[model samples]
Target: MSAATVSSVPIPSRGWRNDMVAALFWLLTVVGVLMMTGAWFLLALASLEEGTEQPKALAAGTTMAGTTLWLGIVPLVFAHIAGFALCLVATTGRFDRARGVLWAGEAVIGASLIGLAVVLVLSGGQLLYTPPDYVP
Candidate 1:
């Protein structure tokens, strides 16, 4: 075989699920950041709202609630992380099994991301800029 002869690259067989999972991984990554950021902001605002003196007291309580809500995403993040591992497996030559895991993770991640988005939005409280009378 000459150097010019090209070797065939092994392509991972992707099912609908695998594609979906990969999509979810990306989607979840975005949502996770948003959720975490929103949580931090809420906590910070609580500190500000309480003023300099009782921050320890106020922050503590709100932090607990935020943490409880934030904690819900851990498993989904883990699954999505594992889904990435499965994707690596697909790259390395295992497509069939990895695909199933990847897609399952995708669904989980997607659902979790959506949940996080919803939670984050709810947790965000009312939009401060808008007046009570304002509706559009």
Candidate 2:
């Protein structure tokens, strides 16, 4: 009599779906990062301008612009690093953990971008508009 043994491999259900989801997350995060970079650059350039008539407005605008630039860049870098880490975990067959990380990173990056946009819009009045001069 002869004995035989069979080995079973773990096959994930809907593996393609995970792949697609991860791909989409990466794509959106990449685009967000690029836009953040551009926004930071523009903020820096605007902060360098010296044509504002209102000294208080100019000072406030400069500080807000610098803060917004840092806020955008730091979150982008963190998101990128987190995304890469999630990819590594995925490759190791930890799909669940990877998915969770992807969502967290996406949220962080999204919030950062939205915050930057809001800051830019709110500061536009002080930075882009000139105030009327009044004799003191």
Candidate 3:
């Protein structure tokens, strides 16, 4: 509503926010895939401190089930994200407007993946070094 914003550039209209929201959702889905991959990698090679609880051998039967869910979901989510992006691109009708939103969404997706990586590495290292039963 300001002169600078109004005069300098054009804002999107006609379902622009809807398209952007869809893009953001898809971007988040992509990030979810990366997280699942990291988690699955951890599980596939998952080890722990001496006498640490094995993920499969957890006291609860649901632990391994949950792990399998997450691992299996990575690819399914990947497909959804890909399809979502393509849907937006094909249906949006405005290439220039959609492009900016796509770029922004992709940026968010990249940031999310980086954040996941950092958390995984730090927490994994800590878990590897510290045993859960060690409380003093």
* TM-score winner: 2
lDDT of 2 by residue, 1-136 (tens): 3333343566575343466666765565555555554554445344444224236656667423344345444555665565455444433333465555556556546645664665566666343333457689
lDDT tens per residue, model 1, 1-136: 8655675775546543466655655565555555544544454444344343344656666433333234334444554565455444433333566555654456445544564565457657531222135356
lDDT by candidate, in order shown: 0.48, 0.51, 0.50
TM value for model 3: 0.30
Quality of model 2 by C-alpha lDDT: 0.51
Clashing pairs in 1: none
* Candidate numbers, best lDDT first, in rank order: 2, 3, 1
Better of 1 and 2 by TM-score: 2
Tens digits of lDDT, candidate 3, 1-136: 7778669667756444566656665565566556544543453333332234444457656343343334434543564466446445544444466575575466445644564465567666442223457456
Q: How does model 1 score by TM-score?
A: 0.30
Off by over 4 Å in 1: 1-17, 52-136
Question: Which regions of candidate 2 deviate over 4 angstroms?
Answer: 1-9, 12-17, 49-94, 102-136
Q: Estimate the TM-score for candidate 2.
A: 0.34
Top lDDT: which candidate number? 2
